[model samples]
Target: MEEKFDAIVVGAGPAGSACGYTLAKAGLNTLVVERGKFPGAKNMWGGAYYGPFLHELFPNFWEEAPVERYIKHRKFSFLTEDSALSVDFTTKKFDEPPYNGFSVLRAKFDRWLASKAEQAGAIVASGLQGDDLLWEGSKVSGIKAGGDDLPADVVVVCDGANSILAEKAGLRGDLSPKDMKQGVKEVIQLPREVIEQRFNLNGKEGIAWESLGTFTKGIPGGAFIYTNEDSLSIGVVVQLNALAEKNVKANDLLEEYKQHPEVASFLKDGKMVEYSAHLIPVSGKAMMPTLYGDGILVAGDAAAMTLATGLALEGANFAIASGAAAAETIIEAKKTGDFSKTTLSRYQTRLEQSFVLKDLETFKKAPHFLENPRLYEKYPEFVCDMAEKIFTNDGKPREKTMKLLKQAMDGRISFLQIIQDLWQIKRSI
Candidate 1:
């Protein structure tokens, strides 16, 4: 394993695979080391892969990739105990090529992506975990994995949200539970036609649904359901600190979410086939680690590159874009034969110039805004209460919508509180 390569990519998820594929495509000797038995074995995501980043790397990827469905609509649900309120957006244009987004199973998706890297001439070594970083004084020289030190001129660390190698290399400090989230999901098996019928989806079309309210026990988190080809990916993401404070297990919250009438309807007659959980960094760019150092670059979740902007939960897109940016920087360094921090700083600059950083910066206040308890508690309850009033037609004379809105707000929330919440939303968004 002492064989040196032009670049070594640790973690074969989207970010690592993208970096490996790009470097190898440029004829650089590249190696990908994955800790899992195979790429995506331990990876889990909420299902949608957004934007044009992946298309730039692999045009017509959906044609050959193991994509489950193309998302035709985005639905947001607000819930109370017995009631559910939602908003859905569907565009026919999104159904065309280079589609809006696709529902993916990470295990299958990552393997296909890793295979693409192999096809592009990168060596992929799976079932190998990087124990520590091999360093030359202040520079990262290679990766120490499975009792062997594999040398490389530059190392790209995309080792997920909880990255030990980044810490060992002094690239970042320990992650705080306050800044992370625990996500628990179940892949429910159902016939493809059955799933389509339940979700109102057509051929290869799917819906991405997210909900907020009593699901997480008033915790500052939410639940999601993404339609797959023959199954449904349903889960709940709860703030780690809130989970601890409430002394509730993530699985318990997911169970309660499943029992909700709205959620139960979707899972009717569906059998649970797989259960998985993960930790996600939700702190946006404020919690990000140094993007690059001498001979080393960190991309994807390892650098806290996830964006939770209320409207959408984005990770794969950031991971792929960051991986490409890191590869571009390394290619430049290889041309100059210098892997110094000064030259590698281009990785950060490239990310900044791209949508990866621009989008993150745009919604930097999201994490903090999400922390407000009112969002997951009072606001959803109020909205559902208002909806109940408006829709429940009684024998008596009907009241105006504005009157129902006032009735819903009265006693529960004050005018000042409403104004403050509105002001915060305006400022944060």
Candidate 2:
């Protein structure tokens, strides 16, 4: 007979780690199985993490976690063929304690987090990919992995974005290609002093820049730059369907983005460090899978919690928070010995009650809205053209600003279309 535990977490990411930590802290038997050689061995992100959730899980997380830098500034830019229209902001409040966000390399952070769970008493085993869910008459009985099976009253799937287990169990369906954002990322290295001097940083303070311009070559994705301790993480994410339709290869696009006049300046002397690619669940609300099944719960990117709002790709916080919730729900299920869909549904309720669901539901349109073809192609060009006209002082009397704006709109977008766009923007955003 397979040994039974209170809970089994399949995937030692933030969500799984959080759940395991909670269960173990409650003194219940818990086992976490991971496919990677170590937790986060395969995870990647353009990755920005909100610090509060981690701080809540382990107070003074900054004192121990492998964080890159504390971000105090954020920049957004519109890029054209030659010029850029940009806005930048810096706040000292963000530079201090209770820092809002930080950059991370998923590999180091995820492993550290899983270790925390282990210390808290959860058994964490790597290279044990969650292979199948053992079902006893429509109820999740346990998790089978690494050619062996272990029993559990409840199993949580935090297996991540392209979860084969979630789909096989009929909790999620195959993802539509258009619903995902395929991204290629590279971490570039520069000397610490060089980064501080170039970005004007003080100690561990950092800056982040996000762009919606020529980065994707109008294929409907964006580029981002974040300052790390001694390196810069920069990359582009494009809509997959748009790429195939445009006959664009992912690597070639990254090369073009890096060479753009505005983007190139930042990399003047910085050397390329690491290159990686991963898929992101870009359709926030539209893509979420069923939250619960008999004795099973889903969290993190596996549940489609990443919000792709303008300039922000948020998933890590969602991972940690939802993971905690799943853990808490299981504790209650353990008390009543009722791991049926009815009892396990509490995980869904807690997740929905948390900001994880509220925020994701609120910005349901942002993912597709940012990817809307017109915003990627028409608006950036229109803004650039308008900027070109106003900044041009050729010694001749220039047309009125409104007249220039109209000219910029003429061939690119019609007056009627602009009116419709404004309405859609107002409604969706």
- lDDT against the true structure, each candidate: 0.91, 0.85
Instruction: Give the per-residue lDDT digits (tens) of candidate 2, residues 1-429.
Output: 658988999999888898899889999899999999999988888867874878888988887989899888888888766778888888778978879888778899999999999999999999999999989989888988977878899899999999877897899878987888888989999999989888888898888888877657778888888888889999888888888888887778788778889888778888887899998888988988888889888888888878777756788899889989988988998898998888878887897788888888788877756766777667888998998999989999889999999999988898888888778677566
Question: How do the residues 135-206 of candidate 1 rate in per-residue lDDT, one tens digit apiece?
Answer: 899999999999998889999999999988888888888899999998899999999999989889999999
Worst 10 residues of 2 by lDDT: 368-377
Best by TM-score: 1
Error of 1 at 295 (Å): 0.7
How many residue pairs clash in all the candidates, one count each? 0, 0
Pairs in steric clash, model 1? none
After superposition, which runs of candidate 2 have C-alpha atoms over 4 Å from their true positions? none
Report lDDT (Cα) of residue 321, candidate 1. Answer: 88
